[model samples]
Target: MLKIRIIPTILFNNFKLVKGISFDSWRTVGSIMQAVKIYNLREVDELIVMDISATNNKSKVDLDLVNEIANETFMPLTVGGGIKSIEDVSNLLEAGADKVSINTSTFNNDFFVKEASKMFGRQCIVASVDYKIIDKEIVIFSNSGKVSQKVKFIDHIKKMEALGAGEIILTSINLDGTMKGYDIETLSKASANVEIPIIASGGAGKLKDFTDAVKNTDVSALAAASIYHFTNTTPRDVKIYLNSEKIPVRIN
Candidate 1:
């Protein structure tokens, strides 16, 4: 049995850590450095730092910030946002990112996924997808959920996997930051359609949501923000609960 991982996603805007509803209404959370240190102390499975300003602002990843977070974090670090080429991916990895997640590029030039995987290996390439159901069709969103590409969800997942992506970070724009729960329906469909590990993002409000996601979907990981950022649910407590429910989990 594979243990389900609990990861904290830190959204960056203008090189600062912020939180928002459905990826909008941004509010400052804290310094990225402070948040990384806290997650390190809590022993979370992994941490993802995404620069929401990257492509939207016509810029690249802030390596200075990446270096700061990298130096402070002890777990595997996944970085994303505004990553357009292999050179950008290389730069991020050199800055100590364990994985590079690509979103906007996939909609335009998906071959970048294979190129990135070839240069960094599949395990180091994560496909971060922003999706929403529009008129009953799962449409892909880019540019921080402002742009929607009308691609069926399964089609996109298959293409990414075939292109050598190691895993999938499927986020539900509708459920993001809502704290309602994960889009289990979407997760179930995605898991059944892809063999790669699925990381469920958005709408995690409680320990039960995490448990239900791992149990109901084939998600290898659960990613959340507000629950860990504003609420009382510690990764350790969530792990303990999952363990009690007979779900395999790594206790640190």
Candidate 2:
């Protein structure tokens, strides 16, 4: 059986590590490099670093900063934000990212995901799907949750998988940075629909939340930011808890 992964997320904005409730009211957490160095010692399965401002600013991901973080990250590093072209993917991979997460570009360019996947291989492409519950419905959002894609959540992930994305990072805009818990219903449905690995993101508040999602859903990995940023709980703590609950995790 594939061991469940516990990944820590770094939301990078204006060169600082920040977190916010429901994707707004952003506040700095600490230095980006500082966070990466800390996770390196935590036995995390992987690390996701997103330049949350790059897309809104109409710029590419900060390769220099990614290179800096990549140098310190001991595990696999997935970098995202402002990834619009195959060149951007290539640059990120060259800069030390084990994978690149694509969001806005998947909606805007149409062919970028397919092209990037074909050129770089699907394993290097992580399609990021950010959504909000609108009128009791799941709506896909892009441009860092500022614009709605007007696409159904299930259709979007299926389309991304068909387009050659190796995995999907499903984040709930409603739950992001809230640390209340994950959107388990949506996560379970998504995992049922996709053959690719699904990284359950957003709203991980405590240790029970992690085990809850893993026990109830078929998600391959769990990703969180605020829980790690605001709480004393480490990734290893999460793994140990999951292990106690009979969930398979890499404890060392």
Clashes of each: 1, 0
- Stretches of candidate 1 off by over 4 Å are none
Q: Estimate each model's TM-score.
A: 0.97, 0.98
Clashing pairs in 1: 181-203
* Maximum-lDDT candidate: 2
**Per-residue lDDT of 133-214 in model 1, one digit per residue for the tens?**
7788788998889898877778999999999999999999989989999988899999999999999999999888998898
**Per-model CA lDDT versus the true structure:** 0.90, 0.92
Alpha carbon lDDT of residue 227, candidate 1? 91
Q: At residue 216, give the lDDT of candidate 2.
A: 90
- Please write out the lDDT profile of model 2 over residues 4-34, one tens digit for every residue: 9999999988899999888899999899888
**C-alpha lDDT (0 to 100) for residue 136 of candidate 1:** 80
